[model samples]
Target: MSDMEDCCDLQLCLDEIPSTFNLEKAVCNHGFFMMAPNSWIPSTKTLRRPLRLADFSASVVVSISQPPGPSSTVLLLRVHREQVIRMLRLSERDERNVKEFHKVHPEAKDRGFGRVFRSPSLFEDVVKSILLCNCQLSSKRKKRRQEKDGANPVPAEMEGEEVDLGNFPSPKELANLDADYLQSKCKLGYRTNYILKLAMEIEEGKLKIDGYEGVQDAASCRILIKGISGVGSFARASVLMCLGFYDEVPWDSETIKFLKHVHAREGCTKKTIKSDLKEIYDKYAPFQCLAYWFELLEFYERRFGKLSELSHTMYHKVSSSTQMREFNHNHVL
Candidate 1:
């Protein structure tokens, strides 16, 4: 069986490690890390961000045996360094990116914006972006009520469902599933067809979704994602950001809320958005996406507690409702 189909779990040992490898900072928020709240292993006061062997990519489950402390040597799941960089965006090589970002925003000198959470596959990133586009803040209280009632989105495997790979569904699995079953069970809404089409095309080898990894430019990535059904500008931007491009900051109602809450930028409209984003985040330049996300992480850390210490149940309360509205969404982490 391919790695995606086996139950094998392993630990990664690294030769060279980045100085900014804090597990607390890396897996801070469910939204930031793409990990389900329930999936995170617990931690006590002394030990933060306790090691857990959750799904890494496709079917490779491994744990980070060590946390980022005084040591320069980091331990991770035994994946290629390129794959690690693809997921966490952290490596010794990323020090330059972090240094450049800090040069623009001096306040972030100590804060670790070095890590940005992402999915194991570009397809998963695109799928989650579709879910994000459908999110609404119209009823925050109602969303919380659903979670409090134990109505959060369940992983495909946890839905009394099983496959050769007990993690995220492979494209073959997704392509074979009944469309109606995926929609109602996963609460995918109109995105069902979009996701299924992508899965089908990939499974048949008619579309080369994986090949985009070789395309180094974000603009090209955006164009590539735009071709998929139901992928709008926001979704494209989001997928690009996850692909480590950061060419644009995918803004939504949450962006408006954060700007008003933090920067006191009232009356931000479409005409004013460019200026607003520029004023607030342009200083971080090419790394503006990371800068914005780091600020969110910082805010959550102070308001809530360190995410590592919080139970997955409590984490569910704060995770995006949009995340809870999809099928197999939890597996995206």
Candidate 2:
């Protein structure tokens, strides 16, 4: 570790950033890591063969030929050496936001609240948000099919399913893909049209997806994001979360359930969701999303382990068996 400490040695350090940048909270920072396609191994925090933004010509390939284990973070990082550098661009705005957040919620200073996980490209984030809405049905179908075939039907990683957890297809790549191919191969369902429409828009210059990099106002940003076909309020909020805007909470059924079960609140229907959230978490101000997420992670860590520590097999078992308990014996005691 000491030998690899210099930025020049690894070519990973920005002018001021340290070699030992912390990624401990990345797994719990957002749903991207958890819901990511199979190429992303959550346990080790390794993205296999991610495409570098600098070079779309080919993926930054690295071999994971050996068996999975409780590999060191250093070992895992070797697999994504270049992509890590591209993903962690700490801008002045990000720094200011992080400092402001910690000042308001000093307790979250070390808990990784301010720094959320993001995809290497905005295009990836947009597509991932679409996938989040539709993939559950496909996963269910896969689960049923596996059961019928008497396959292990456990987590995909444990089965060593040799699928290409390939690079998130670029807009050009996606624009070229037909609807049938996206639906059949990517299991995108009806989301296939939305994704293709977005990709085509980008490809044709009707929408400047990269211009969103300068977006400052969350409300305006949400409006712009929601204009994408099939993007609803929840999906817009999620994309905002990934983009470092935490003012809006992505309140969907999962959010409602978590709020009710954890806060012991009743009568929290969709109509009253905003008021219910405000009553419980307005104290955190602009960083209310962080507060909600940290508490959620606390619940998950108690029931399982830190999500990043769970191996593929263990992750499947826990994800399948664990239900949210309003009052866990451990919490009560």
Candidate 3:
């Protein structure tokens, strides 16, 4: 019950840019901590190991405005300053790559795409990924309806009337919950069983869900997590990204589509996409490829709608800034 002071002048960072939504609330609700802001408790032994916000740097960049007008805003967060620098250099890395992406579709450059920031916690990243599984863009509305009807959606806080279940549940709590209880909380449909099994496995020490720093390789950790039930290729890749392991390629449906139409014209099988992504990014060290893949996907999504055919071309674009900005803009506004 000790108070943890705001070690960094995050407010200065916030003041430097104009965000359409509240960045502090977005970060908190995204589950950086269970308690409210300015009232942070010292991290538990387990939480301290995987969630390290203090070690990283974050920034918010708005594309439409130079000083960032109140209307259009882009928020970027990065764990390592070097990663942020590398992402900024992506536009310059290969003019051909940028132009080629645009040549296939002119609007690609206009689409405000690129890394905004990075977070240090794998826990936050993993939790956000779980919240996104099997859920369609339209289902968000349905979730609201369910909440209004007293469906008792997950116990997470509601930003206004909408439930903000994007935060990761505590491992202790998740491990203790039954399959039926979790389904009721998450409204996960068929994915409920998978979540329940994952929880139980993690709880039982069958899965090492935490303590990732000692692990040297992202692929090895991904392989371990993928062994858990309901942890598919997409989920495993996401877990890697969240943990500061940047070399993975998460192949969600949108990424699949983008590859087939935009990146690889001959039409891509899942195998080819994986191989090509690995080959194209092989020159970069493992994990660095993650940022590239993420930027590519974000560019695609921003230019096109969430469900657009172009979304499937790239891999690993699910950054917290994009998710938070979208959730706040759509739900809070």
Error of 2 at 126 (Å): 1.1
In model 1, state the lDDT of residue 93: 41
lDDT, model 3, position 195 = 56
Q: Rate the local accuracy (lDDT) of all candidates.
A: 0.60, 0.58, 0.40
For each candidate in turn, the TM-score is 0.78, 0.74, 0.48
The global Cα lDDT (0 to 1) of model 1 is 0.60
lDDT of 2 by residue, 253-307 (tens): 7777887889877688899999998987788878777777778777778888777
Q: Which ten residues in a row have the lowest lDDT in candidate 3?
A: 40-49
lDDT of 1 by residue, 1-333 (tens): 354322334444444444556555555543734343213444421111111123433334333435445664554444333444555555444555656766787666676556566665677677777777856544775556456646655444233233233345667778888888787677667878888898899888877888987777776777787778878877877777776666477787777877778778888876687679888777677888777877777777787777666654454456665544345443332
Candidate 3: residue 167 lDDT (0-100): 26
List RMSD in Å for every model shown. 5.6, 8.7, 11.8
Query: Residue-wise lDDT of candidate 3 within 31-111, one digit each (tens)?
Result: 222211111111210011112223323222211101234443443332232322222222232223334333433342354
Worst lDDT window (10 residues) for model 1? 44-53
